[model samples]
Target: MSKKNSESDSANGVRLDKWLWAARFYKTRGLAKDAIEGGKVDYNGAKGKPSRMVELGALIGLRQGYDDKVVEVLGLNDQRRPATEAQALYQETPESIAARERKAADRKANNGALVSEHRPSKKERRQIHRFKSDVFSGESL
Candidate 1:
C-alpha cells in the first residue's frame, strides 16, 4: 500500500473531536469536543474524551438532537472535508438508521397534532382579552 493509504489507515487513530468534526457529525471541533465531554458521544460503547484516539472500525454512539446514532469508523481525516467525503468516514448501522427514521416520522406526526393551521378569529381574540382583563381585575370570567 502507498504511504498515504497506510497513514490514513494507521492504527494510532485520530482525536475523537477532530474526527467527529471532519466526519461532519458536528459543525465545529468545539461542538464535537463539548459533545464528547458531555457524554453525548461514546466510543465502543464507552464514553470517550475529546482527545481520545478513535481507531478505524471503532464503534461510536452519538446523540444528535433527539436522534441517537451508532456508526463505525471507516476512515479518518484531520481536516474538515466536503459532505460526501465526510460521509465516507463513517458507516451507520442499519438499525440506527431505521430507528432515527422511525423517530423522525413519529415526531412529524405528533407535531401536526400540536400545530394550529391559522390564527384565532377576531371574536376569539376579543374573548381572550376579556378573560385576561377579568383575571387581572379579580373578577370571575
Candidate 2:
C-alpha cells in the first residue's frame, strides 16, 4: 500500500458499502450494496464483489440510474462525513468524467421522462378517482 493509503487503512479496511457511503458515492449503505450487487460497480475496470477490499489507487465504477461515474479510491473512512468532506475521499479521472457526461446526455436524449415536470391531465385524474371509488363501493355484482 502507498504511504498515504497506509495512513487511511490504519483504522482497518472499511467495508465496500460503507466506503461508498462515506465517500459520498451513494446516499446509503443499502444503495451502495445494491449497486455492487447489480454489477454497477467495477474495481480496476473488472467486476467486483460487494465484499472486495478497497485501498488507495483502486479504480471504482458506479452506475446510479442514468449516471455512470468512476473514482479512484484515495482514503478509507468508516464513518460518513459531511457532503463537502465526503467528496474529498476520492479523485475522478478525466476519462470517467467524460464517460459519465456522455451517458447523462444520452439518457436525456433517449428517455422521455417527465418525472418532476409532469402533472396528470383532468381526464387521467378522473380515471384514477373513478377506479378507487369502484373498488371501495359496498355493492358488488
Candidate 3:
C-alpha cells in the first residue's frame, strides 16, 4: 500500500495524453496523443502537446464529439480508473457546462427537421435515379 501510494504520489504532473486517458477523456493514450497533435486540445489557453505535463488547476480545452469542453484539473492520476473515479480528477467549468447544454438543446430542437418519414422503396429509388439522369441530360436543357 505504501509502495503504491509512493508511486502514485511521485508524479507532480502527468503527461497530457496520459492524464487525458486516465481522466477518461479519451479511451487510449494514443487517441489522446492524436487529439493533442491534431489541434483538438489546448492547455492553459495554448496548444497542447502529448508530452506536455498536466498540472493541477490548469485549464484544458478539448473537443469531444460535438461538444467543446473546458475542464480544470483538480488532481492528477497516472493510471486509468473507473469512470466515477476518473470524473473526480477534473471539474468541467460552469461556462463549459452551459455551452454544452445550449448546444444540445439546439441540436434537439433542429433534429426533427432532419428526420425523414421513411427510407425510399426500390421503386422510389429508381424514380429518383431517373429524375437525376433526366435533370442532368443535355437534351432536356
For residue 61, what is the lDDT in candidate 1?
A: 98
Candidate 2, residues 5-108, lDDT tens digits: the string is: 75566366766787898887788889889889889998888887777777778888888777777788887776787988878889998998898888778788
Specify the highest-lDDT model's number. 3
TM-score of 3: 0.76
Model 3, range 68-133, lDDT digits (tens) per residue?
999999988888889999999999999999999999999998998878799999998999899989
Model 3 Cα shift for residue 136 (angstroms): 13
Give the higher-lDDT candidate: 2 or 3.
3
Worst 10 residues of 1 by lDDT: 1-10
lDDT of 1 by residue, 1-141 (tens): 576864764456788998999999899999999999999999998889998888888999999999999999998887777999999999999999999999999999999998878898999899989988988889643
Provide the TM-score for each candidate, comma-separated. 0.73, 0.65, 0.76
Candidate 2: the clashing residue pairs are none
Number of the predicted model whose TM-score against the real structure is largest = 3
State how far residue 89 of model 1 sits from its true place (Å).
0.9
